[model samples]
Target: MRVVVQRSKKASVTVDGEITGQINSGLVILVGVTHDDKEADAAYLSDKIANLRIFEDAAGKMNLSLLDVGGQILSVSQFTLYGDCRNGRRPSFIDAARPEQAIELYETFNRFLREKGIQVETGRFGAMMDVALTNDGPVTLIIDSKDKKA
Candidate 1:
């Protein structure tokens, strides 16, 4: 499991010109699942992301977690995160999980976030969607469950 997390002031996703998910003062998370990703991976990431202290504090220090500020999440399914372009112009999606497995884990990841008492909104999985956001601090980070060093 992998995610590209972007801190945002406001965000929304549109499908077929209709708003699907939207949020204010939160993170826009692009989630991806690989062939070997499991529920444990989703759990780990949800915990880590909910507690990541990327938001600022009263003293202008980056010390507030999303939990601290009561932020929302705009989650988007992004299989292309696993695209492998090492040897050719065309990206290979062989490392990406099949839709059946991917959607299950993706829902699990969102459920874990909601269980943590955070509001989560999500785009339609496997849909052609349009996402827009006002990136607060332009702060973004990439995290992968497979990179846990323990």
Candidate 2:
């Protein structure tokens, strides 16, 4: 499991010209699952993201967690995160998990976030989505569950 986390002042996702999900003063997370990803991967990432102190404090220090500022989450499933372009002109998605497995883990990841008492909005999985956001601080980070050390 991998994720691209972006802190945002406001964000929204649109599908078929209709807004599907939206948030304010929160994080926009692009989630991706690989063939070997499991529920534990989802759990690890949810915990890490929720507690990541990327937001600023009263003294202008980056020391506030998402929970500290009561931020929301705009979660979007992105299979293309696994696209392999090492040797070809076209990106290969062979490393991405199948939809059946991907959606299950994706929902599990969102559920874990919601369980942490954070409001989570999500884009429709497997759909063509248009996402808009005002990136606060332009802060972005990539986290992969596989990077967790034993």
Candidate 3:
């Protein structure tokens, strides 16, 4: 499992011209699952994202966690994050999880975030989504569960 998180003023996901999920003053999480990913990956990433202290504090420092700010999460499953482009112009999704596996872990990740008391909105699993956001400070980071396993 891997995730790209961006602090956002507002964000939303649309599918087939219909808005499926939206959030304000929160984070937009683009999630990907590989074949090696498991339930524990979901738990680990969710916990990290919830506690990540990237938001500004009272001193205007980046010291507030998502929980501290009572922010929401717009979670979108994006297997394309695993697209590998080493050899050809066209990207390869060989590292991406099968749809069934990806969807399972994707939803599980959101469920874990919700369990942590943060509101979570999610786009339809396996759908082509249109995600838009006003990135705050463009605060973005990537986490890979495989590295944590070491």
Collision pairs in model 3: none
lDDT of 2 by residue, 1-150 (tens): 999999999999999999999999999999999999999999999999999999999999999999999999999999999999998799999999999999999999999999999999999999999999999999999999999989
Which portions of model 2 show Cα errors greater than 4 Å? none
Off by over 4 Å in 3: none
Model 2: weakest 10-residue lDDT segment is 79-88
Per-candidate clash tally:
0, 0, 0
Model 3 scores worst on lDDT over the 10 consecutive residues at 141-150
lDDT of 2: 0.98
Q: Estimated TM-score per prediction?
A: 0.99, 0.99, 0.97
Better model by TM-score, 2 or 3? 2
Candidate 1 C-alpha lDDT tens digits along 1-150: 999999999999999999999999999999999999999999999999999999999999999999999999999999999999998799999999999999999999999999999999999999999999999999999999999988
Q: What lDDT would each prediction earn against the true structure?
A: 0.98, 0.98, 0.94
10-55 per-residue lDDT for model 3 (tens digits): 9999999999999999999999999999999999999989999999
In angstroms, how far off is 55's CA in candidate 1?
0.4
